[model samples]
Target: MPVLRPLPTQGAGRLADRYGRVATDLRLSLTDRCNLRCTYCMPAEGLDWMPSAQLLSDEEVVRLVRVGVERLGITTVRLTGGEPLLRRNLEGLVAALAGLEPRPVLALTTNGIGLAGRAEGLAAAGLDRINISLDTLEDDTFARLTRRRRLADVLAGVRAARSAGLNPVKINTVLMRGVNDHEAVSLLEWAMAEGVQLRFIEQMPLDAQHAWQRQTMVAAAEIWARLDARHPLVEDPADALARGSAPAELFRVAGTTHTVGIIAAVSKPFCGSCDRVRLTADGQIRTCLFSRSETDLRSALRSGVEDAELAGIWIAAITGKQAGHGIDDPSFLQPDRPMSAIGG
Candidate 1:
């Protein structure tokens, strides 16, 4: 297992891995429960839910965030969920995290069905960024993919998010071959018109049933080809790599202020450049999305592990970090947990 050094002071500095990659961003999953059942993400019916007792309480989550920011130098914290907004007292959690001494950059990723009602409250709670997952522009396609007929609600949440000053709100679209690949540019166009940014992610092998196949993924090259034909894309002039280990490679439309991004996760893995770590809702630490194993932190937390010891466990998870996610390797294995269970 990966092991990390303890904080020098209360909130002193950077934490690096065995390969010298410093982890500065943390993705924290609040719950494994979600309202929608996206075909690519989870099952449609009779999904197994994590027992309430397994989930991190608001206090435990806040304490972990304290250690992350105060000790591990985690400057960014993105709250995720099967659908984060589904978690009650979410604003309270946001407020607690934002109130940390060295306040981290707090953001959220949600399906947006519940956002219209809570965007303002969350922003007021100090959420600086927001990303909404909207796969297709067509209402029918949205229903078919997510098995939820609530696209209008998601769209309204987008408007509410923008109005609430979640500047440059992002829309995450998972591109799939023969499914929504044909609508890549249209999604971009729609985002531009909606006054939000667009990020297209090539589908990966994080589904619940191990149903994913390499041939089924919509490669970033194809999405880029289609988008370039429509809007003429050029690499962002401002340093792309300088933005730390963000997965998206940004692009600018030829003559417009509008921008688009492609997270070529599978076709172009950024594992070598990955600088983020994950803390699952049930309190397991995963070094990478496709990590073969997880270190159980909830057990240690309940066992009365000290803050420094908990922080050490956090660092240990990094020691096992592979150079890459190994999607190209002949022996690569999809994570046993689906995106919903893993944190999306």
Candidate 2:
């Protein structure tokens, strides 16, 4: 594991409160546009795209990231969106982030439509890693899930990413019960063969258009049991940084050295170690992916607040971070914003 140098205590201490968690991983949505509309992520009626004017400028995003790194101990920056690669000049942003002092580890999450063409450029421009969303291996099922008949394109993108040397390229698959659940083992087989780390995610309740039933959720333990029956498994050492921020629990296959991960966010909520913060393309700061609340950072940035002053606003926001999202509550309403709008 790489050692993360402790950030300067002056500005960093301002963000720490009752929760020992300091905002280290910043997920920034570059755009709300996507080429494919997955059934679980967007409304069947389509999405209302945010206006270009409302989106934060690339320079503004860079400035905010600098402040985040300086004051919030943000060391890893993940570029996300309806599909981050959809944004123009994405490489420019990657370059800017790469030039940051201490140079945060920059990564991206994409639907993999445009990545085939841009993967090399992005890697050359300093993107350290990538996570591609792939729901099913069956072409027809993928088409049904994404409402796009371009499964070949997505697969090409994945291969392109691997060729570009994106370390440990992660494939995120949402394990929808009765839908792609039957393909779980096959997906793992494909991942092991391709040298990609496969992550099976429990269907989250954030999809506004989909009627999420708790009964449809495949718990982590159940998935483990099924997978272990075919191939004995062992847990990997717990990753402190990714513990709660990410939903995945990692495991290594007994015979093969390849690893698999399961993200049971709904069945097993890892909220105690949550240390991530999300910034929408429009500049709203979201403390949690399932959060209904947001702080308007666009107004603050446009108001010409200095970095230090803006840092204070971020500190205040982190201080009020909820311990965990109560997704099981009957009152738990899907966020008005979709995953595309929320940056994955």
The most accurate candidate by TM-score is: 1
Q: Per-residue CA lDDT of candidate 1, range 1-344, in tens?
A: 12343333332245566676778888899988888989988888937989999999999999988998888888999999888997879999999999997999998999999799899999999999999999998889889898989999999999999999998899999987777888887898888888899999889998897899988788889889999997899886584746457889899888988889899988887776678889999999988889879999899999998999998888777766777788888999999888987886
Give lDDT tens digits, candidate 2, residues 237-333: 6653445566678888887888899887877777776668899999998988988899998999999999988888888887777766778677887
Best by lDDT: 1
User: Could you tell me how far off, in angstroms, the CA of residue 97 lies in candidate 1 after the best superposition?
Assistant: 0.2
lDDT of 1 at 159: 98
Model 1 lowest lDDT segment of ten: 1-10
Poorly placed runs, candidate 1 (over 4 Å): 1-14, 239-241
Predicted structure 2, TM vs. truth? 0.93
- Please provide TM-scores, in order, for all candidate models, with all chains considered together: 0.95, 0.93
| Deviation from native of the Cα of residue 238 in model 2, angstroms | 6.8
lDDT (0 to 1) per candidate? 0.86, 0.84
